[model samples]
Target chain A: MWLRSHRPAAALMKKSEGTRRDFLRACIAGAAVLGTGGSMELLEAAEQSSALVKSRVVIARDPMLRGAGTTVDSKRALNLLDHAMQALFDADHPADPWKNLVRPGDRVGLKVNALGGHAFSSNLQLVEAVCERLQEAGVKANDIVVWDRDTEELERAGFHISSAPNHVQCFGTDRTGYEEDLVTYGSVGSRLSKILTRSCNVLINMPLLKDHDGAGVSMALKNMYGVIHNPNKYHPNGCNPYIADVNMLPDIRTKMRLTICDATTAMYEGGPAYKPQYSWKNNALMVSRDPVALDYVGWQAIERKRAEKKLKTLEAEKRAPLYIATAADAQHRLGTNDPRRIAVIEAQAGR
Target chain B: MAREMISLADVKFPDVSPINEIARGAELGPRLLPLDRRSFLKCAVMAGAVCGISAFAEPCAALLPWAGGPTQGDSQFTAEARFYEKLQNKKIKCKLCPRECVVGDRERGYCGVRENRGGTYYTLVHSRVCAAHIDPIEKKPLFHYLPGTLAFSLATAGCNVNCKFCQNWDISQVRPEQIRADYAPPKTVAELAKQNRCPTIAYTYSEPVIFSEYLMDTADAGHEAGVRSVVVSNGYMQTESLKAAYGKMDAVKIDLKAFSESYYRDVVGGELKPVLDSLVTLRKLGKWTEIVYLVVPTLNDSDSEFRGLVRWIKTNLGVDVPVHFTQFHPQYLLKNLPLTPVPTLERAKAMADAEGLHYVYIGNVPGHPAQNTYCPKCRHLLVERVGLTTGQILIRKGSCPFCKQPIPGIWHA
Candidate 1:
């Protein structure tokens, strides 16, 4: 049989409702199909769990400093870090962003975009602070990894490599590389970073503030592009559906827990790289649990920047980050502007 | 041009003794390629023989020469690209490839490099070079062409489809802005090819079809500077654009990912028909073309399945089109299976041979006898090949010196 011909939901249903006898019988029947080590029990519970219903994305902000420049003092970085984390993982939220969302002893992978080569990238200070906080929140730092596509690019962006205990580790997929592979999203089977999907229990995205040439704006969903092996192939016709399609892949979206876009040094135009002329936006960090909304807001901010420079909007440049809509569609969410469920928290640029 | 002496002294033909005669007889087309000494050499060399045949040299080379250098010039970079039609509301639809990406005002295509700005599609990678290097023509695996020559290889970021098993994923799978790219104009790239002692310039790594304008200009420049051009591509392209592009290239390498249509749909996000169409187009155009079937273990490699593929090639592209069954190492998304076993590769070779396809070879496994060229008539080794270097040639004047059977290839002296 063709690989995709099997029903995905059937496997989950077998795990959820079946008795021990049925489980064993199904296992015998599915052994040939499921290969080795089939787990119907866990699969059933996960399928029935409300957590997978619709993942909530929170963007925490202070609301006071709506505008700021790049490079606030370390103290201000801490403030932004604190507010961002609280906004997403606050205990008071109905969804229980931390307790119910993140379990104890779950490995957290912090995927950062440092490909800008030192100019515009995720603030290492903010990421470090997030890592420290995750450790404090009962997560192990050894289980936490800060990574991107290449170690050289990460190091070039001022990320110190580490693998010791109680400290944030930094590396790219290219360093250890993807030895073992994970299933890509869609019928389009692109390989993802084994580190993010296989090694980690959950993923925390830390994308840089930049304008992508293809996807309009490189935000949370675009940040996940580094997880796959052939991200380059995803950009055929505006990289819309492909970027959306790649993010829709099981290894990326399903495991992504939190996304914090580092608008600290925003690249408003000609980006995903440092255009220099488009650099030095501000010390702004937008944190969110929902990658789609976070990136939608990021796209808004980039268009705002282009407007400030008296330049055209991303749409005028023929590069709106359409993948956000595609992602929302895949997740069965409303349009980007649907006020029924979407929430935005404005914040001060610096502490 | 200085006349150079060429010699063949140690080439060997495959041992056809073990093969069943009936299967072997079916491989040669209805009008079989001449197996005699003089005739076989002409057939072999005929693939890349159009050195000065037509006015479309640069375009032809641009379409299929396989590799080239990255370059840029001081000229104004932006030029309106083809395949886009303007519409109301400042929107446009890119009709270039099968994916007719619609863009409003200022938006790029799915490839990330091409953008529709104010209802005009512009290629961002035009005259831009992301990665450029001198590699063996064998790396492109244009076995039937000038095999041992060096090709100035070049590529820019972005692709038309998303394949999970991409080997050059770091580059081919990213946007132009995501990677580090330098400005290298067509003339500059061609000049670098000359300076680098490369006989051919290849648009490889990333899809050249997306960077059609830049490749066309570069191919023209390369030919002007006395260098050949080749294109290594997925072959998922529109007929008009592909024909126009391949007109300038000297040779073309098409990656026939799989035989199944659904495999292209589910795994590659592309249609198999376009690629197959490209093969037919290339053949009819008389472009020096070769097919590469990446034998992804458990994905595309099946003995009986690949046998059907060999049959298709024999029927469509003719028996002389060198079909390379390259081994797949676990990569990108499909890492569940191990690297294709060498025996599996051998089995595939055996299957293709059984299907009556001539010139079947296994790739990525170095030091295999299939890498060399052989005379069908006498079983004499015509060209001994190791990687990209030619060890020795036992054919003199395009004919096997020992048995005097003509070996098909571009044997110039």
Candidate 2:
């Protein structure tokens, strides 16, 4: 219904010739001044550029966790995380642009989203496995900091409180004015936590896959809200452009090396939380360097879950994955909603 | 012709919450304090107007117009936030808004600030400023506070909302790191505003709610230096944090997007109750509160809605609260729509007047007669205005010169 209302009734405008070059030029120029220009303008351009990069979402079907029975074993989660990471990044360094940025001794900041408790948050086992792999790949454990917005939530999700000196320092930005001095958000001055913006050589975006009440789906880009202190202010007119725009910020996106979304127990509706009745435990993990594409596939999975339950469609709920289109059409980094350019692969767990 | 509904079989998986009895509030770990919506409004309205938080509003105000410029100095932007819980595999949940974002190992929040990294959530825009500006206090449209004075404005990237017709979409609609940012610390912002002779620092442009921490610190500094503060914001806020900050500023301007709940849900993605609650709270706190209602053609400019809004303001906030119905320009995602017609703005002003709002004015249309402030009882122009610059005030000690009806505002001798 939302798409019906918003889908430009007029035929889509043809991509103007040289538009891609113009966008790329703008992006390069925008990136050049990332240190000086206002963060919001950089975000706007990047977001618009990301939206222009049209990509397809692919969900690997044929359940992998179908046979794994009953037991609440933590090891299974680790296996899945390891499987997903290896499948996505492989033994080889990420291709092209990312290949040059990621390396050993890089203080890799593992950006995680724990808005959902145990049911819907990133699996600790997966996080540990991935960190271990990073260490194996030459990144130091002490250099890796697993963080979010609140220490309490971290504890609630069974995260070990890491205040020990020299260990992977784990702390929340919620501690008195932690994000208070950070940059502003648009004309709206938004403060972000210093940990995400000020301290980290490389960032690894890790978000859970879930249906969001406001945005159609919450993915890697949306996970950045934990970087800032006040998110309620941005929840306007469905948080469409702002959420998409905020995700494009250079401080958040530029420092990031990859996006990896967790879809093991995908929440289809009424989520960001685990709804057992409405949840679909596909027990699969998804990883990608492209945040937009990662979320795109997750959105499709959510739509499928809703359909099976006879629940309201994203459109019926007055919400849809409009940001994906926005991210694709943004700076024209991605094509015009075409899946051909997006590489979708399926890999099984290997010994 | 109507189309037939599709079968459910072809549909895909939906994002649904667990119905298990265990999947209640504890799973999300509610950090949001229990405060009534109205109380939250009060906090939003009073933010930065009080002493300690006065510094927070200054940097926000100064950063608005200068978003595209060079970083002033001494601010490095790189780091991540803390606070989140990791689940199985690589999924994480953000504990920031009421919407606890349960993200996989690699994801972000609905606000686009927090992110999931290896099963942990981290903030990404720390100290990254996207926009900055210095303008007259009247530009913030905070008429009731320091009239004719100037303010320093600032903002970063990212908002919680996705208003299709956002004027500042270039900035307010993106993440902090996506944009270029300047390094203007609270002290630098305060010094700059002070150097520019701005008595009050204002946190305007975009939504100040998203940058609470930045605004808070800026407000603190401004107060220490004897500079007053103000905030122009959409009053959607969580009460606990807002109250803690409200005790630090001098004035506030709340953008009442619309009066109807449906309008808020569809067009603003916010609840009307929160805004109304803020206005009432501002009134009770004795803070200088003004409201801006941007009149979008055919969207929020309905006479009935304006009338209802006026009635509510009169009954709840009293007739003293200044209400401005500004004209809207077609931009951003809503360019297909036409600019708000001048007549629509006139009608809105009339509706407010008819509903007994004493200080209703039309904005964004310079040189209009309604632009000047008229005494509620005497009908005398108390303070004149031409765009953002203010003219002579005919009132002495907050009273009209012609009829002596006292005007309510922070007027100087």
Candidate 3:
């Protein structure tokens, strides 16, 4: 009863045509200098970023993207990512999508889910492509930080720990530590990652597309748990109000620029960690500004896959991602959870 | 409808490795901790130098062996947790706490340290010592338990409840992996307690309820080594788990966060009834237990709440239970709130005293008169304590020396 429909209304926007040579033309800069804020241009950037709640969530699927096992083709991965970004911002240039999402001077952070370990994790290739796109958008490679909760978890998921002064830095919150001050939002009282608070001005949320056993969905909104010091405290009650409330944190609600989910390998069940038997190569990446809508679409996709696998629906099992509706509720007002209001843009991006 | 747009694509991500390490490690049956000094240094350089654990989870100074090297597969640190039942779909219901989290495969419960691996729940924090120190037994404020003695303290990361005013939030509110920990097994813990000349080993700094397995093992180990074990906890746990876990405790100190359910639900992220039930059970078991009410300025410092708490303690656990009204300083998430007024704590003590409790004292104030344990019958100063230091002990043969009135405590350690 919680999920209103299995399929959201669809609209696949036309992809922008940007030549490979165009993307390769931009030179990678020296490592990003941490904490160098663009304080002068804040007013204009803030104004342009404070758009109303967006309801568009794009699904860029290409079956040929996944090779034998979970190995993802890096070139095709970068191509799909570029198309998805273009479609997300409705931009024409290959780099225009990233430029539209974040300013060149804005410090970018990619919060990836590393709990799944290497065999099944947010594809490192996908994150690398995002770093490449950010650099192409004129965002200094050093300015982008790719991080998760624990160093070991990040390493287990096959991420190399790096703080290279002239390259895209990847590490965990443990390296930067959490702010001493606590950020209380709804029921969550946690210390946010210093990497997010001190180093990055904007965040790029890249969550693994998986079905959480407790919360029923681990998607864009749920991925923000990595930014805070205490995510374990908010998992009770199907992570309902906590997930929505976490997104309600002003820093997350505002500084979050976009969500790019890796569905190249999605988990239908037994997740937030990978289970080989339940896993499948979904060959898709989802992009959106609206976390709630993206989650709604992701939840529906998992539900559909579960039905095909002859498994009980998440609702039947009493673990629907109710946070999607809660996020759109009056108190949160994060984005749209309504199927009617959401536009699921489906595209075979690389085709 | 807002003009929101989402883009999806199948990105064939390319070119990277070192991710396959876990697959190889898992097939090879977990990594072991290194034992030698050279191996320890090598492990640290390999683990920490790569911007791995060393740069992030700083190794504890007292660390030894350092096997798993702070990444994963510290097999010795994990033990199947008690009080959880496997359900369908690789999910398990953790009956350890009231939350009773139904965790899926490879997921964890609310405590974050215990994980459900393939339907079998394993506590990753087993023997994981993140913070260890020797503190005064009075520091645990179990004045009635063992006065004028030091207690060896240990804690693993993770607490069942999130109190806004947690003084030890750095260690209490974190996952075990998030903090740097020493690999001290039960025997090691017992040995450390003995070496430190502590009469008791205190399971503290974080909620001990979450590390029930560690506490139980350590308690047994301490007993074998001629040392007693005590636990300082939030008392928010399942009674069945409590009876089994706390049953091994020589004594317990419970931090009663609040008196009302609303305060518990809103401020402590827990329920009050379970904590109260645990207290009653402890009383029934005849295990020595002390209660500490941290009187937050506005939240739990109401007169009615104090009266209710003392009255409940009196009616349920009897007047023999020692209740300490601790001062609450602004910390964690409740910084905007003022320091819990001394008058507030005094008021709580006053109410509990008026409610016919025998042993009531004010804590966190170094030299307050109430810091001394006076005879309930003759008002003679029985045990004089200054802050965490014991100044004088006049109780003889478990009775007030001045009046010979019977005192309920282990006055002679």
Give lDDT per model, in order. 0.65, 0.61, 0.76
The fraction of correct interface contacts reproduced by each prediction comes to: 0.32, 0.04, 0.80
Q: Write the per-residue lDDT of candidate 3 for residues A1-351, one digit (tens) a residue.
A: 111111111211122144553222111100101112553243223323424223678899877786554588898899898788777666677787776667678899899989888877789999999998889888998999999877888999999888989888888888878876677777777778888888888888999889887789898989998888788888878888999999878788767877899998889988776787888888899988777888998999999999999999999999988888898886776767878667788877667
What candidate 3 gets wrong by more than 4 Å, as runs, is A1-54, A66-72, A103-106, A140-142, A151-167, A276-280, A304-313, B1-73
Output the worst ten-in-a-row residue range by lDDT, candidate 1 chain A.
Answer: A1-10
Give me the displacement of residue A71 in model 3, in angstroms: 4.8
Comparison by TM-score, 1 against 2, better one:
1
Total clashing pairs for each candidate:
89, 212, 25
Task: Please write out the lDDT profile of model 2 over residues A135-209, one tens digit for every residue.
Answer: 666766677788888777777776786857566766666542344233533323355667776668688888888
Using Cα atoms, each model's DockQ against the true complex is 0.18, 0.05, 0.46
User: How does each model score on TM-score?
Assistant: 0.56, 0.51, 0.79
lDDT of 2 at A39: 45
Would you list the rank order by TM-score, best first? 3, 1, 2
Better of 2 and 3 by DockQ: 3
Docking class of 1: incorrect
State candidate 1's TM-score.
Answer: 0.56
Worst 10 residues of 1 chain B by lDDT: B1-10
Candidate 2 chain A lowest-lDDT run of ten: A1-10
